[model samples]
Target: MSRPEPLQPVYQFSSAQEPVSLRQGTVEVDFNNDRFCGMADLVLRFLPGPRLVFHAIVRSTSEPELPFFLNVPDNLSVSFNGQKMEGFRGRWKANGNTLEFDWIPRSQPVVLSDMQPKNSVAAIFHLFNFPEFRGGNYQEVAPLGCALLVLESEDWKISLQELPEDATREAWDQIKNEGGCFLTHMVKMERKDGEQFSGEDAQEQCFLLDNFLSFINGGRCWPVCGVGLDASGETTWETFASPRPVRPPYSWFNPYKASQAELLFPLFAKRWQQSAEWRDCLHSAIYWYVQANTSGGSPSIDAAIILAQAALERLAHHYLVVDQKVVSGKGRASDRLRMLFSACGIPNEIMDATPDIRRANGTFKKDTRWMDAPHAITDIRNSLVHPVSKKKLHDCHVDAWKLSLWYLELSVLALCGYDGTYVSRLTAKYVTDSANVPWGKKA
Candidate 1:
């Protein structure tokens, strides 16, 4: 028929003539040309997410650069780690030996799976070649050569292929040196292609990175209380032994073990309680709060506030127990309460009043004031507990909560007859030094 259509030009090639190799972590892949006969340029890409997916594109070398297509034969097979992958359509034709497919070994969270083989790099390889021309018919061409492709997880990519093991360890050490608190954020890799990924600048993401590194570095456990250094390089915890007599070991005695007052007094007298001063207190408070609320869970604003309040309460109790006047109840309850108010330096007249303390104006009767600060604190607590509000939360809420807790602790200490200086010191350590607070080593 028309001289057999002059035998459409059919060219055959084999991957056996050319070869390519690629490696990532412990996974390795090799490609050879003899398998498919064709000239082609191969491209590979790696993506990060629930599962690792590798994509490949192959273009055949032709006068105008033709697309590679394949009508895959029944004998052809695709596999990962020696295991044949199922569900391939197997309907591609040889346009130029170009093929595309995902190479996810299994359907699972990539972080939790062991996709990379030990001592072998994970990669996707492509083989290309052209088929030889026959008398008057065309025959399917086998694969010629293959090119390897690699894709890495986001963190792996940012770390430049380095595993997270070391960075985590370093972060842990930093957390241990500071208080028990460890915060970090996620960091996205800078793509060579100049594209930005999601959450690249989120502050929480940065915190996540820090915390992850801390956990991996064995810095999870740290002392929460006791004497420690503050931002100013001065000891924040006031010891009874210090020149300040208001420090600790007050007259208040534990009713159950009055005899042990001597033992407990010395502990209190040794130092002014500081949430920031003692690494142990900070550590313990954070640890206890986290254990009580957030262990093995995601972080939330309410959880953070609850943890902070718990820590503050512990510090307040230690200060209160050490004050002499509070233990003996020598002054009027109202007066004692007033002294507590003065200690924190809050001029709220209601602070010194008893539950029945009436207002001089007499317009509002009954202990409404008692419900005020404590109620305000409770409102803050509620906000912390239930953070799901349509309104955006600002950092000021945390600052207010911290200030309130400090005031509460100072008042408790004042009721025990401790001077107010400790409150000032604590404020300086936490509020004024907020910007200068030492972050753990770079994760």
Candidate 2:
């Protein structure tokens, strides 16, 4: 009988997995755990406007890595976080060496669902590579999501298939149903309990929460990943992104609370973390400004303001100084303050037409009573930085705080490539500059 033909074993989706179930069903998946398969990456189907499909790229981990092959039946249907996440996608191919996915929510316009972005914040790539793309820094952009995404941390490529020009939007919309948006999974960072949060590089975390708060006020809430600092500055602590799922506010006007909300200090807490728009100098500068503006106890007035001044100093020395390599100069920090402020933002068409600020040109058809906060905060900032503690001094603590904040906010706007009413409105909200001349260059 030919030696009974030696028997060979084959793998299956599961030794005993289920057929299919939209609700919930027991499916015993007996796959190799050491193979790196997990519930988070479980490829499932969700039935929506008919049936939304999700295709997972499966691969094996053994030495001779094999493509993970599972015979998924056509009738296979499943539900995950929810049906709204029907377009929610993810991938962990390349033997777990690579990870990324895009999620296009069920919303017609394809917005991100209510899940705090992790490892990195979520954003639309439509901004780049579009007829609408007007160039500058920032990709030239001011991404509203986590800045870590663009760094060399991962190799991202646009493998999108070619499409007819007219079908661009329609084609992308189609890709979402196949799990495009859910490609990149935002993982969390954890540290030992005693570990102190890095104070200098929490720019992304701070701005994310700040923007979240601002968005919520407008009735569109978005969750933010955050970090916390220990008052004692001692503890081997483990911290993760704000695990709190975003929901409606108990008090919309005042939603951000330290004790109540899920606020966390960022793990990417270094001056090195930067977005395309804000360089290292700007990143550190903005972070310092956030530290000073934090709630609960007032920010260290002297320290915060001083750091703010130093940030501007660095900005001028590194970014604006005509001598690109020179770090020092003859003038004091204050003497160079005006020069930096002069180069704060470019004179764009929209800024010219703004109501009460000096015009870069005749862009402003008319003028109103709008005067900018004086750009000469250098003296006050210097006073705080180089203090004469012995002498009982007088300075508008509130004004100094406001001044530093205004300076930082203006710099942020410039980086974002935003100007006009968008920035003007933010100025009113951020620094109470309601004069509509927030971008007004006061040299």
> What are the lDDT figures for the candidates, one per model?
0.28, 0.32
Q: Highest lDDT among the candidates is held by which one?
A: 2
Model 2: CA > 4 A from native: 1-240, 243-278, 295-298, 322-330, 345-376, 389-393, 422-443
TM-score of each: 0.23, 0.33
Name the Cα RMSD for model 1: 26.9
Q: Candidate 2: lDDT of 53?
A: 25
Model 2 has a clash total of 34
- On the 0 to 100 scale, the lDDT of residue 181 in model 1 is 20
Clashes of 1: 88
lDDT of 2: 0.32
lDDT of 1 at 42: 16
lDDT of 2 by residue, 1-443 (tens): 12211111111111122222112212112233423221222222222211222323222344432443332222222233333233333332333322222222233222122232222221111110111111112221222221111211111111111122323344234334342211111212223332323422223333443342322122222222222224432222211111111122111121212111121112122212344433355455544544555332444666666666666666566554543444456666654555555565532122322322233112322342122333334544545666753322233444555455555555544433323322232233431222323454333
What does candidate 1's lDDT look like per residue over 11-77, in tens digits?
A: 1111111211221221112223323222221111111111123232333233323332323334333
